[model samples]
Target: MRSLKKSLVHMLSVPLLLSLSCHSFADLTIDGKPAPHQNLSTHDVKELLADDDELELTPQGSTTASTTLRQSNGAPPAMHSGVVDTTFMNNAGPNVHAGSALVMDAQTGEVLFSKNSNSSRPMASITKLMTAVVTADAHLDMSQDITLEPIDFDGPKKASTKLRAGDKMNRAEVLLVALMKSENPAAAALARTYPGGKPAFIAAMNAKARELGMSSTHYFESTGLDPRNVSSARDLAILVTQAYKYGVIRQFSSTPHYDFNLGYRMLNASNTNALVRNGGWNINLSKTGFINEAGRCVVMHTTVNSRPAVVVLMGEPTTQARNTDATDLLNWLTGLPKDT
Candidate 1:
């Protein structure tokens, strides 16, 4: 099998992903105690593919689905809940390729558009965002140097990474590469060096999720290589919103590119989300993830129509599809009046 790095290179040349396979969900245990409500079965890719008929465009508080959106004087409601506002719905919205997608007002937590948004799916390296948050909240010394060990290369997928076993970087630099480049080894190293190690870091991730009201979210490790690390679009919207509050997260996640000095050589890393590199976007926070089981996924906090918005797109078949969906959503939102 080709390494993940090679596969990603090939993926960039191809227009679509031809096949996908499921990985058995890893068991969850924290400090030798089983974590509650963890699923152990393989979450098949076919299951993540929702039928077009099953698609529904609904708002946060709306009890009934409606295709008709009531526009008051050509402006959408600036903030609304429990009422239908098909601002990004069926024919009115973009042709989103993701199996599950959501757009929410960052400040109000109002879900403006949703498609299977509540369904849980593998989140891939988007897990690093949570890892970054947990690490930040711990208030660890950012200047402390961390050495990546051989075990950092060990993960469920065994994906190839640019970071070497002996690579030395400060805590802040490690977190930066993890979020910006979706570097699995960097993420693993962060958890491995955490207060009580990886297990404790996993616990903190889950605890933070609960505190932020992400009931549908769970974590098994820091790298997101574990298929069991799953979350819904709705749950991740809350995460994106909360993660944007952190200054370092906002800066590192959205940074277009950076050159990391490994003492022996330099490693050039770019943000996983393409939109962040584009001059057109005003992104505040961004994360992207992919594995065979999770497919292509992305979450972003950006400004749209002068209003802060959070977007979560998951289970996309290809990188092009994910980028297109994001572009379409952003453009759709931009067309809306600022008052909306």
Candidate 2:
């Protein structure tokens, strides 16, 4: 009986000793050295824990890098090194509902306003801006005719188009409709007719992005239907700045309306961006886009209070919200000094 009692005591003491040892060393670091917990006050410990939660730490307790002040669509912000205007966070700028946005001096490349500007997200038909850029770069015969094919109708969205498979239009007219109407088929036709076809055109789009220092941008196709065609607002600001150097993109994108002569009839289409037709605003370049994933997005290079600024808004829930943001931004810009 004493022998059995001694065995029970041994077992119980072993567990007690093991528990005490674990409790004693719980404050040790991975290297078996004592942690700096002795120097940490209760408030300091609380602050450290709070910071950990804010950083979106991994399972291994390492923090992920983020430039966005708020999360959008549960997407982590892509790494970017663009200049940011930290003052925008303190109500020093306009209030906007867009998930990501930026405003920059078109000529100086100075950022004036920024909100989640580095979060890469789907850009919708805004992809056509790059399409327009690539077409202009090739200097292809703008007068050459391109016949729409059945494959032109294919896209991730399978969007409807007025142009039929057999319809034909000169390259310039095709570009006009694509930029002004956000016509997916028109863009696809341009890609299909490129020197080496769609593959080459897509490559050119990505290459152009790289050349422009758009590290956070990527393109899988000319049309923005693919959610994979992503860019941050800051990168898009750079795109708009570069695109402004092209007269065709500026003219076609800003044109309020265009009438395409298809031999048999006139197809009238208006610019997708309403601000261009507003008359009160001086819009030099404009493009609007929408998709279930991208929400309502808009990019504009316009003069506000005699200051040329490029505005990029992404992931707005509604058109009204997007437009309201734009108008608010314009008003905010107008209130600033001219030199700003």
Candidate 3:
């Protein structure tokens, strides 16, 4: 009788233990703590999981879990949020071949595009722009004949020029050649003839840059052959915009070709900027620059999508690359909304 009673008690305890084990499975956590196990409707499930993490529902009616899981795991967010819009954010803008570049609205000074724009670099013949500006500000006798001297041919590059030692040309003609053709001797002669000579002319250039808020620009010499003649793309854009206000610079820099009687021969000088010579671009102001230190460079004031804009490109590997970069930027700007 005792054994049967013991056996019956053991059988009862076994079924009770099995029942507890089956019902005691782990509960899911909603907010870092265990939630009560219960039958949850779709709405209830959403409400429970909503505060815990961000969830995406699939077309199959299943919750896809947190999209921010990567963030929690120390991953950076995507470069662009949501669907990418090519109009506002162009992936190709950063791919421009120039080491430094900037595009700004000529009238409003609004920056539209930039890459290393503030980093100062050698500006090569773009120095002529400032040379032109300082010469213009002098208000000298543009018609007065100025003779080129040995000091004017002091650059290390030994570039060929139509003007020879003792070759006399009117100040206006000199200015035209200096700007349009990047004539080194003409620029040096302009600085040489300044009131206090080259030193005073360089000081005036710095002063003019300060006046125009080009803090990153500095000029060691009038001719950009000196590698120390440096400025940032941002600063060059400012210089170009200010220079565009001068009608002489606009006309001279944009002239495709100019014929001048040097008495010995009829010398013809063409604009250094190919875009200006191409006739397809409505270039208001243009300048091209190059040296071993500063690669192919260009600055221009042109209308893009009917908006006047200043573009500065520096340290491009090739002239063709620089032109293509400018064209790509122009097309990108044209595609953008007018408000941009």
Candidate 4:
């Protein structure tokens, strides 16, 4: 949220994102109708959670699921599906909390549990998931050298990378750092590097969303700081489903820290997601995001109930709420019979 300055030191051109910026936003549509502004029922949410497809942070900012977990102390509940148990999911412990959430089966793309999964909400930096993915797919030689131009600083929000005009970094190092640390400048730079500038990159992002079957999602910016970058939990699950499959994305997103040298300075990047430290959750793909508009958001891929799954929570009023929502769902997942 700093003032936008002129002169982008980075020499990259972003044709894609610039195009996206020009088009006026259309109201979201899903399943051939206007997107449901409200959340889905818990029952409908539960159905979506059982699917094996889960959110992948574009496999960027993505290390989808580390795997393996233990049983919860509670008795297993009867599941609604051939896979996970709905009754167990319905029975929430006192700690379960969030404004919106959905637990998804990573492999089958089923919903095992949900609260307000259909509502479109601001996503904050989780939009980086798509940013990371597009970078990987663009075939940019990540090892290629580039400088952070001042033009890269004009994102919807502040540039947290502390990059001033003329700072230099490689593609791979910046990509890894930006996704993990949630750097605004790096995201803008990544977008600007694409064809058609930032607008074209954003267009490509929405196009990619369409290709992946994300029925209710759109990206106006790469850093996710833009309030206009929004999606529902249901649509986000589809985003993660395609995101978790990338090897590089998976490695970088799950990493707790990365050290890179910018000339004489050593840049240390870390993730905001506390689940990385939970010890209980075998996190595969995870990203944490927040802004006043979005509250707090987290999307994770993990093995709960001994099966791969995705969990998406958005608009939790507090950081604690985000953690609570994810943890409670994990508890529900662990309590369900593995075969239920």
Candidate 5:
């Protein structure tokens, strides 16, 4: 009985001692071997505060900047090393800028994030995305030969590509250049041959916009070159999502460069989406747009820090500013919660 009692006591004592050992180690890591139940040294508190670089941004130079986020006495003021917060977006960029921007959840269309997204403004060639979707949906014979009519190039609007009355090409090939290359004449041709003409084609574009649940969108032209064609950033995000449904639309929008033939000449088409051709991004879908009235713009579907990300910038004063906005947004996103 004595021997059995000794074994039982040892078993109980082993776990109890192990538990105490773990508790002690967790309660205090030995640095300068402080005694138990005592306050941590000032040096220890400083070490805790100096944990890994939390913001993950180290600015280029030693010059430091901090905004007064709060003024509660003895409290740590909020600070960030880079990028604009979601709460103060409109004020971050150019003072002359006006227009909404959005970054949405692609699958559910649930608005994960928004910035003045409902304010309508000219969309520029971003309209070509919708035009491409509608043309692909029309199910017209892709192989059908479209003989370029003199009227195709004769509209009051200035022409971007020279196409004469006699030039001919297959419909699908032209739509490819229209969408991928943003060849204005090709888009005009596709719209012209639809049952009616420019007027009817535009009506269909508006109807399609309504179908996509775009409330503030209006289309005065098929290609977005016409400054009168306007849509809110909220509406454009939906337009972009619908445009992604067509496989060719996604493939062509991501294309950085291609060779295209206009009856008389073969020209190289380069994507305006700087980020795709840009070495830094993993861009799956993208498009850049502009007109003097619209300012510079870009909408891209991509991934940052292993999470789905949509970065859109508009109304930048300079072309460089648009690029800077995207870069800043991406850097902010990579540090946000749920990024991994």
Candidate 6:
């Protein structure tokens, strides 16, 4: 009976000893050196732990201090991983007055300079570029004449056009008017006459945007009068590049002037983009837009420094400001005089 009692006592003492051992270890210095209980205060423990690199615990549960700190704090304020951040170099080049702008290499899709390139804003008449693309891609009968109707005039904003309610023009001619002169009614007519009508035409525009990797672009109407027709400078650059692929779009957009006759009367229209009409630069594709919400907007595929490039300028305060912004960009790229 005494032997059985002694065995139980030994087992209980064993657990007590193990607990004491753990408590002793917890009271020691973080470097594994023996420390008195009085020296194991919270401050002392923190200091010891900080000095002992191997015992340091990181947010990621790793012992590497440098990497852990960097990961915890994130990248520096000025560093941009993927998109171009022009904050540092805003003054390095010409002073651009546009609210947002982008210059990209058309051949390689490389961003040359960007300021808020991903910010979406109303695109104004530049929306016609997508309208032209969708119309051309549909392979509609270009010679089929479409009569101007009151429905085409349906929009919140009234657009100026010489075509009367009963005036008639073929699809190709209307497309030219839309691209060259930015005629809102002509663009709406193109969409209205599409196989699935305006809804399908708008759907095709968005579908084309997706196909071209314009993730930040959206279109609500063929004419850009709706402030809802919005896109970013980056997306517009992609658009200008894609639109340049179509020979007809390039031809029509770059045309200096065009005349249309309604048999009883003649309506003459000129390209809204003065750069195309001025013949001062080699502009392969050009489109301009304006609305109260959109400001002055322009997108072009032109030669910069003898290399193909796409330039997008949006939210300029005035028509001259938009033109000046484009000229300044071209001059900077091509090494022209700063005063030019």
Best by lDDT: 1
Question: TM-score of the candidate numbered 1?
Answer: 0.74
Look at candidate 4 and tell me the lDDT of residue 100: 61
Which scores greater on lDDT, model 2 or model 3? 2
lDDT against the true structure, each candidate: 0.69, 0.69, 0.68, 0.61, 0.55, 0.67
Model 4 accuracy (lDDT, Cα): 0.61
Query: How far out, in Å, is residue 35 in model 4?
Result: 45
lDDT (10s digit) by residue, model 5, range 1-340: 3342232222211111111111121121112232233222333322322321121211110001121112113232122212222423312332224345565434333343445665677877787777776776666555567777766665435646644567676665566567656667777788898878777788889999887667767888777778888776666766665554344455556655554455467555566766655547756567777788888877776656545445555566677777777776666655655511
C-alpha TM-scores of all predictions: 0.74, 0.74, 0.72, 0.72, 0.66, 0.73
Q: What is the lDDT of residue 204 in candidate 4?
A: 90
Per-residue alpha-carbon lDDT of candidate 3 for residues 10-125, written as tens digits (9 for 90 to 100): 22111111001112212222222343333323332223223212222221111222211122124322222122212212234546888888776565555667666767889999
What residue runs in model 1 are displaced by over 4 Å at the alpha carbon?
1-91
* Ten-residue region with minimum lDDT total, candidate 4: 9-18
Looking at model 3, residue 105 earns an lDDT score of: 58
Candidate 6 C-alpha lDDT tens digits along 1-340 = 3342222122211111111111121221112232233212233223322332222222111111121001112322222223544532222566778877887656544555677776778899999999988887776666567898998888979878777788787666688788988988899999999999999999999999988767668899999999999888877877876666554566667766655667777676678988877878877679999999999999987765446667889899999999988988887777632222
What is model 2's C-alpha RMSD? 26.6
Off by over 4 Å in 5: 1-98, 108-113, 154-159, 162-167, 261-264
Residue 169, model 6: Cα distance from true site in angstroms: 1.0
Better candidate number, 2 or 6, judged by lDDT = 2
RMSD of each candidate relative to the true structure: 16.7, 26.6, 33.0, 16.0, 23.4, 29.9
Instruction: Report the Cα lDDT for candidate 5.
Output: 0.55
1-340 in candidate 1: lDDT tens per residue?
1243232222212211212222211122222232332121112212212111132312221112221222234343322222322234522778788878888666555566777776788999999999988887776766568899999999888886788889888776788889988999999999999999999999999999888767778999999999999988777877876676554576667766666767788787767788977747777679999999999999987776557778899999999999999999988877765544
Candidate 2 — worst ten consecutive residues by lDDT sum?
Answer: 16-25
Candidate 4 ranges beyond 4 A from true positions: 1-95
